[model samples]
Target: MMVKVDRLSYNFGPHWVLKDISFSLDKGEFLFLTGHSGAGKTTLLRLLYGALPVNRGRAQVAGYELNKLKKRQIPQLRRKVGVVFQDFKILPRRTVFDNVAMALEVRGMPRPHLERRVRAIVRAMGLETKSYSICERLSGGEQQRVAIARSMVANPELILADEPTGNLDFDLTMHLMDIFKQFHTYGTSVIMATHSREVLDCVPEARILHLQDGRIVTDSEPGLEEDVQ
Candidate 1:
């Protein structure tokens, strides 16, 4: 499995955000975290990616024990997980190409290779023309694509997205989901947090895990109910 969580729990000060949550995902599996607001979907993803400490239980990603890995080990772990946020985090002053290429640069990819990889991802995200344009100049959907390009350029084994398609129209939303599906096809495990039933209906084959008030209430995937048991 690419991810494993056992009896995981988290609290934000006086509020218990996640309680006794447990789930696992195999390599290349695509799953959805669906829930209403404040249901802990974001918190769960943060735990899996090691952004937040697993305050009450065990969690592992790509075989690195979250609780045991050292601070220096975090960079290695993050290299295996690509995170896409609902808000585009690209630097407004930088060009699209520069924004996407920053990840490769941080990982110390050589100049020529960084250019090649960033261009490939930008093209894949349908932002080839916008590559040299400043990020602040792009439209909302285009900016979102830049964020996706940045996330995917790393080619991480696990892709974690928080509301990747939250603010787009139907067409753009489908386009983004198709990009995620491409990542899944390339053997990257994908877990996305979304509340839209429309998104679920668009991708009916994806395993759906419903989170309600920090607990998983339903898990549905054709012929996989037995696996859950």
Candidate 2:
């Protein structure tokens, strides 16, 4: 399994954000986490990536127990798990190539090999012409693509995306979904949090984990009405 959560729970001060959640994801599986704005989707993703400490129960990702993960091991953990933020967290002043290449550079990849890899990924994302363009000057869709390119540049085993297509139009959202599907076809596990019905319709085969009020109320194929709570 790529991820496993057994009776996981989390809280902020006196407020509980997640409650006794349990689920598992296989190595190449694509799972969609659907919920309203505060349904704990983002929090669950954060927990999986070690951004938030596990306060109760067991949670393991990529073979590492998040509850026992050390602060010093965070960088190593992040290297194997890529994340795409809802905000498209690309550096505004950096060029497209630089943004995508940063991850490889941090891993001490040789400059020549790094350039080849980054260029190939940028081209795959249809951003080859904008390789030297500053991110802030790009449109919303372009910036979102740049962010996806950066996350995928390292070819991590698991990708956690939080509302990746929230700001995109119908065309752009479908385009991004196609890109994600291509990656999934190559055996990368993906967990995307979204509230878009269009996304659900596009990936009918993917499993849906519907969250409500910090609890999973459903986990089944898209469009099925089964309630798992």
Candidate 3:
């Protein structure tokens, strides 16, 4: 399994955001987290990506036990897990290529290697020409692509995205979903949290887990194997 959560729980002050959530995701599996606003979907994604400290229970990703992730090792662990947030987080003054290359640069990747890899991913994301464009000048969908490119440039083992398509139009939303499906085809586990049914319909084969009241109310269906490719 790429990710495993055993009786996970989290709280903000006195309010519990997650309640004993336990689940597992297999290698290359594409899963969807669906829930209403204020649901614990975002919190769960944060936990999986190591953005939020695990307050209780056991969690592991790509073999790194969450509880044992030392403060010094968090950065290294994050390099193996890609994350795309709802609000596109791009360096306003940086060009698209630099924003993506920054991921490799921080990890000590050679400048030559960083250029090759970053350009390859930028082209793969259909932003070849925009590589030199400033992030603030790009359109919403284009900016989102830059964010996705930055997340996937490292070719991480797992990709966790929260409402990645929130700023995209219907056509662009399907385009991004197709890209994610292609990534899953290549054996990268993907977990996306969103409330958009239209995007979910684009890939009905994905396993959808519904959350409510800080609990996983509905688990993956037994017959979903046929629908999920």
Q: Which is the leading candidate under TM-score?
A: 2
Question: Would you estimate the TM-scores of all the predictions?
Answer: 0.92, 0.94, 0.92
Name the top lDDT candidate.
2
Clashing pairs in 2: none
- Give every collision pair in model 1: none
Each prediction's whole-model lDDT (CA):
0.85, 0.89, 0.86
Candidate 3 lands at a TM-score of 0.92
Runs in model 1 deviating more than 4 A are: 222-229
Off by over 4 Å in 2: 226-229
Q: What would the per-residue lDDT of candidate 1 be over residues 30-121, giving only the tens digit for each residue?
A: 89887789999998998887778876989989999998878888888988899988743789899999899988988999999899899888
Expressed as tens digits, the lDDT of each residue in 1-229 for candidate 2 is 9999999989988989999999999998999998878889999999998988987989999989998899998898889898998754889999999999999999999999999999998998788999999999999878988998999999999999998987788987888899888889999999999888888777777999989988888888876845322
Model 1 global lDDT (CA atoms, 0 to 1):
0.85
Write model 3 residue lDDT over 1-229, tens digit each, in one string: 8999999999999999999999899998888988788779999998887888986999999888998889988888888899998754889779999999988888899989899999998998789999999999999888889999999988889999999999888887888888898888889999999877677776666788788878887777424422321
TM-score for candidate 1, residues paired by index: 0.92
**Residue 28 CA displacement from its true place in model 1, Å:** 0.9
Ranking of predictions according to TM-score: 2, 1, 3
- Clashes in model 3: which pairs? 205-227, 205-228
Q: Which has the better lDDT: candidate 2, or candidate 3?
A: 2
